[model samples]
Target: MANTRPLVAQWSRLGNSSIAACKADIPRPALVSYQTVRHASGKPASKDKDKKKRKTRNTFRQYDLKHAMQFSLIDAMHYIRAFEVGQNPASAKYEMHIRLSTLKNGPVIRNRLRLPHPVKTDFRICVIAPPDSKAAADARAAGAALVGEDDIFEQVKNGVVDFERCICHTDSLQKLNKAGLGRFLGPKGLMPSAKTGTVVKDVGNAVKNMVGGSEYRERMGVIRMAVGQLGFTPDEMQRNITSFMDTLKKDIAQLSDRITKDIHEVVLSSTHGPGLTLNGEFKSANSIPPKELAGPL
Candidate 1:
């Protein structure tokens, strides 16, 4: 086929009048019309997004480390209980905040332990297992709030995360992974995993253990958890506190590559109450030095 000549002439060969006429004929691009009517739900555009939520000073409660008053565990419990008088029993919980002498970049302390007196007894556990298998039967018998294989996966995919804890039998691990329920359960920290000890051979034992247990992990060198409720007696509070301390020490020791872990400070407080500095006698018999564990050194 013969080559076709270009239709338009080069701009350089065009006369000034022709160029002017072409420029006039060329339609000017329309101005971009922004949406002037702002929607009530839309976030307003702002320049300094980072500084929007920033605070110039620390406003939250800051404990005094220099002259901390050491209250005994029982005394601290009593002090917190006093603040709970006539308050909602369900909301009155004794919380323990342990400040570990570890750096933010240091190894984390994470473990699960059965509290002597469970802070809360209503544990809604969900078990992932074959619907007709013995694991499911055992899980149901052990008081699982929800148990099923495909049904559980479907519910999770639909964002129906009604349960607080989740346990899976080893046999269902592949099926669970294939379901791709991580997006739904991962953020809630309810996905069954071997690391969390939720993936187990015995579903019944796992359910039972989690029902009466509590998991604690150090975040920013601080471990915080609700230890007991206001309904717990003084003795129960003491036992729960002691059990937690013992479990924490034991978990650190059980590490394959052991490192010296120190407890910097122990503070006991309750909901709607002041934080009382514990005397740090919980680690009195432990290997940690009392001086370092008592207060800021």
Candidate 2:
């Protein structure tokens, strides 16, 4: 009985010491805190608060051709002049915008026309012909500003294309193609080609035709070109317009093969003016009321 009592007392003391050591080594979770942890509120997040506010964009208002009013050639010119009040009368040009009822992928309508009163007189034409040859001399006499063969090609290669128009004689067309100047001249519409009538057997006649003449081309089913200066008389402007429209119709009839090149609408505009649609016959003085411009002028 005495041995049993001692054994029980020693076991109880060991258990009590082990329990106390365990309690001292363990830490209470309440002492540790997380100050960086975020809590969900009904308000927006902190990241959203740092976002930038969007700004309102400015816009320019322009005249829409869909809502344009049809006017006679003379009336349209006068209206355009009204818009060019503060601008130079001589510097402002009369532009014709012709919309064709043709496919965007249709054949391009490109040609040159000599107006009654030329819109511009300062056209620098470059002629590709043998230097000091009869063709070169004739080109110079016909108002070719630059006339040469190898010299002109070298100048073009050096990126010194000082001419606005280019014409190549049939004999020099091969040389022009071999010079690889198309990379430079094609984009500028200065590459001489038989399609555009810039390639010819008669260099002098071609140069004379190009000088003071306006070239028009179809793009996206529309052909736009400056017809005359805004300072031209309405009669002169009418004649120019007639010559151009007649020539355009004739060219379309002659050139169109797979697709029709019918003109759907023709709009007249100035450098800084709104486009006005042409309603009356291009060759006559017939007047039409402004369908969109309703108020008193």
Candidate 3:
């Protein structure tokens, strides 16, 4: 539970450096496990902050596990409930927060969070279809039409769906609040509030809704109930999955065919939750964590 002589020397140099390049390039006080760093067993005994009585006398900083070396960010953010004698100063408490003592306006220096690209859907539904043929476009744009993602865009681009078509039959859109929208919006990286602002009478309105930046929020719940129902058959589950994959593939294809080359891992799960675990898909191991990428906040 101590900054070794070498580490202290290294940190001191970093702390006092005059050159902005190396100093800025370096991030100090990384979350390191005293257990792993300890050459002996005399490190401070581990304590659970949740179980102990805490006062404002301690400091804590949250960190992302992937970027913070060994410990996860949530775990790294924990503070010491009580201090023990002979604890190492650096190891005495949880201090993962980025402390910018000097910079008034500069790059943030801490374990940052990233998100993956959204899972899009293929234009399967008919209502949202574009005016590939005047007949096809006229059929739906004139009246009741079934729509999908692409079709929605097509109609909007060609002037099909509009304010009239967007009129809602149910009051679903109004129910979307900060809490409900955050659930799927955050993880899917989708900028929409699943319930509210989902319906539109016209294609122009749908596109405009997205352009206007509808209700998008970050997810706070890492743990959840289920992405889908538990009892779905594999084929049924696959239909939903392919719908998602089709969208993902289309977005990825927009970049390059060799996109798979950058893949770190590919996991196909029916529903990631308790009791029913359905996993089957051909994927690359190189697939990176979604949060590592920039996403709609």
Candidate 4:
């Protein structure tokens, strides 16, 4: 906010270095670029120096310590359906589901489902498989509670599934609804029906990982985010940068093709009128673009 140094100059500072190390020792330089810390006061004018707009630069410049400070990351893609940056919230009621599929080399998802002890916490988990044992095995790995016909009926009879702590595993589909598993779970929207991927004979491992939070999902269209604010410690921002970039990289690798088609862009920027963002126009294994979506507009 005060006397910020140019990104290139701040690149060598102990503060930035220390901050980078704290975030699993991520190299600050990799998360961002040197020029990102510095820039002309304003946009580049058509001429070398526009007398009318003296403060602005005629060309694009990178953001560094002097020009940019702080960063934030948000999964705008996962944002609820029908979201727009400046649109009215009343118009949007998001009802989107994130789907994940397994790759040959992807990690085996932990079966255990972790939830807060309170039954009303609303992080409902459904373990589905062709047979009770298969679903149980995956849920067990994730540490999810295992339920048989007995548990399902009680929940339905009581008119509530403990989203906070409830697991159902049954090979018989009829037993579930006949006992009223649907009545309670249906209203809460916790019931695992055959329509959603929840009832797959063998959920691809990626979905299990998603249930575990290690999984990544990429869908079409643009999503926005504001990386950070006007002035933040370099150390304060590296973790976000690292996590965002890592997930993005994994997503790209998972899609050998259609990376750009699915991923429109990657950007980063501050919440104000100025800052640096990766202007990667297209997606490819060679380059990862982090776009600064919103908040800065």
Candidate 5:
């Protein structure tokens, strides 16, 4: 009772000084609105939204699972053969070209496929090894058109590389390298390398494989390989094409995690006919329109 009235008056007098000292020592932060703080920091409140928009623009278009096409192996063959059969001279042969989309760091894929129905061609193979070596004898026995080391080298040096495929033994590699034939063979894709299975220990097996194998190489993101000739039965052609596509799919599956898209489109055509794009989904052989052919056969 004695101090109550005076207590407020007494505290006010004491501290003007104490309160000012306390405030100075604490160093109070300035009161700023959220908008003012953001402006001062030079960062927009919508920065996250802006980033999201940019990310969406750069990403690949994601197709819905329902919209994905399911192509029929048999139906694709039917349409492809129909187009070829209608060709003027019936195209010397039918070729299958597959185009792919890949990421920057994707694997460089090349495969040698032996189709169920081989495409018959006039292409010949030559073997370079010691004339008396077993490899040379094996090569000769295996159907190599030409087999000799120095003789083959001479022919190659003199601009007489008539063969489409060249196989060499490990022993002759040094000689070939010394001859500086790389400048000649490299551009033609006839140079023998381990990767292409053109350099081998068993010349017989290599030559045999080369004779039957169809090389599918990825160049500029496209794979071009001969599926079968127009002379083949439709059933044979279908099996060949299906086998190739199945193998391709399996190989690509190994790299699926890093791939952007496995295949963009698969267009089938003969040597002379217009291409028919197989829309990832299969259609019945009877339902496919013959007029889907791009141009007059």
Candidate 6:
């Protein structure tokens, strides 16, 4: 009976030691702060810190990219003119090309701006009208390069197109096709289509205005147009560029929800110079961040 008592006591001690070891092996709850908890879980405690860091990185990238872009329209014009030191002034028109998001049959936008400083070039204009008609005489008075019916037809048929633009009386279109000028003029975008307001009864006015007008057209998701000449002053060039941007914005607004954001990038270049991207300062207020402008435009 005495031996049995000692054995029972030893067994109780063994059970107690086992319970103590089990308790020592178990983990206790950590008393960390909420922030530490969040960090441990692989999330940021405060989003602002991350955002600020991202912004700083973006600013650095923008600075790096500045060498490839101009700070403003005035700056771009200066660069373009500087690059034109030895080039012919006649071919020194400033061109702007905008990349846009992918669009399915996007709207064809055309705007005519009477630039603050008009491009001083001999803008050759051809008028397709009956030689005996008053419209033909008026076109000649408007300084049209060529004014004739069959003669103009023959010139176009012989691939002797010397005009920058073509103006036609609505009735004269049949004559143009009969001369087979479509294959020649269509490729040059000089075909007098009704959509471009080139096909009209007032051939004289059309010819005169087109001589001073710059046209913007969307081709394969890009808008390319001449903004001004290198001879224009900074203010004059800026005004012309602003007018074109305003017109473009209005046109995009009519078709989409975010007008300014729709334009992904704007690049300016002269006829003979390398392209310079415009800074984000020209972007609209709602423009997407550079990181988010990945897909289109």
Model 4 Cα lDDT, one tens digit per residue, 1-297: 232344435555645664765655656556354243333445442354566657654222322434432223322221211133454433322111212332323332212221111111223354433335665566656544443455546645775544433333335565665666665666554565553334444433423433423212332232332222222222223443445455554544655453222232344432222222333222234322334322222
Please, what are the lDDT tens digits per residue for candidate 1 over residues 97-130? 9987654455788788889889877889999999
Which stretch of 10 consecutive residues in model 3 shows the poorest summed lDDT? 109-118
- lDDT string, candidate 5, 42-154, tens digits: 65445575777674333333344355444454455555556666554334677777877664345656777788877854458898899999898999898999898888888
Cα error of candidate 1 at position 48, Å: 24
> Residue 281 CA error for candidate 2 (Å)?
5.1
TM-score list, all predictions: 0.70, 0.71, 0.22, 0.30, 0.66, 0.64
lDDT of each: 0.75, 0.78, 0.31, 0.38, 0.70, 0.69
Candidate 4, lDDT over the whole model: 0.38
How do the residues 1-297 of candidate 6 rate in per-residue lDDT, one tens digit apiece?
232344345445765884766655543333124335545688644558688777322111112333554455545555566677776665668788987664445355555555555665478988989999999999999899898889878777888999888888988888777777779999998888787778899888887787777777777667898877666555555677777788888877766553333676788888887787887353345533333322211
Q: lDDT-based ranking, best first?
A: 2, 1, 5, 6, 4, 3
Give the range where candidate 6 is weakest over 10 consecutive residues by summed lDDT: 55-64
RMSD of each: 16.6, 18.6, 22.5, 24.6, 14.5, 16.7
Give the CA lDDT, 0 to 100, for residue 235 in model 6.
53
What is the lDDT for 204 in model 4?
35
Candidate 3 Cα errors over 4 Å, as ranges: 1-227, 255-263, 266-297
Return the lDDT, model 5, position 107: 64
Model 2, residue 255: distance off in Å is: 2.7
Candidate 1 residue spans exceeding 4 A from truth: 1-66, 256-258, 281-297
Model 3 TM-score on a 0 to 1 scale: 0.22
- Cα shift from native, residue 207, model 3 (Å): 12
Relative to the unseen true structure, what is the C-alpha lDDT of residue 129 in candidate 6, on a scale of 0 to 100?
Answer: 92
Model 2 agreement with the true structure over 123-149: per-residue lDDT tens digits: 999999998889999999999999999
